[model samples]
Target: MIDATHDTNGTRYKLFSFMTHDVFGHGQYVKHALMENEGSECLTDAVTSFKYVNPTWEKVRVIIVEKGFGDISLL
Candidate 1:
């Protein structure tokens, strides 16, 4: 969720929210139909809550990914 007022500083924040489901598992036993293959499948098969998109505040381009937060560049 992108929010302009979640903090007292009046700064904008973005949260890319998504969900995952694995009926069998993510290993050899997992079925291809049950894995998270596409965005539409997840949004359509979820028990509740459809896809959500938060408003854009400041655009950013992800440069790197790590265990935690990684490098990014403002657009």
Candidate 2:
């Protein structure tokens, strides 16, 4: 799971759920799978390789519901 948010100040932050699995033992399997692909360039490459192994991997669904600020009213 991934959680990302952008505030009014345009500061964006992201949290990765896999860290918890890593702290435990669940991520060991994932780590091994990533290692199988020796030439992975970055996180995206690892993710792509993982997707190749398990096509049904669960991914967070994000929808941009609203964007941009509305008209500002000054008193």
All models: lDDT?
0.26, 0.32
What lDDT does candidate 1 reach at residue 22?
34
Clash pairs (backbone) in predicted model 2: none
| Reference-based lDDT, residue 50, model 1 | 25
lDDT of 1 at 6: 25
| Candidate with the greatest lDDT versus the true structure | 2
Q: Identify the runs in model 1 with alpha carbons over 4 angstroms from their true place.
A: 1-10, 24-75
Q: What is the alpha-carbon RMSD of candidate 2 to the true structure?
A: 14.1
Per-prediction TM-score to the true structure, in the order listed? 0.17, 0.28
lDDT of 1 by residue, 1-75 (tens): 111112333333322233222346332211112323224444244212322231331232222223332212211
lDDT string for model 2 (1-75, tens) is: 221123423322221112214435463333222222222243345455656765545542331212331211210
Off by over 4 Å in 2: 1-28, 31-41, 59-75
Cα deviation of 43, candidate 1, in Å = 17
Model 1 scores worst on lDDT over the 10 consecutive residues at 27-36
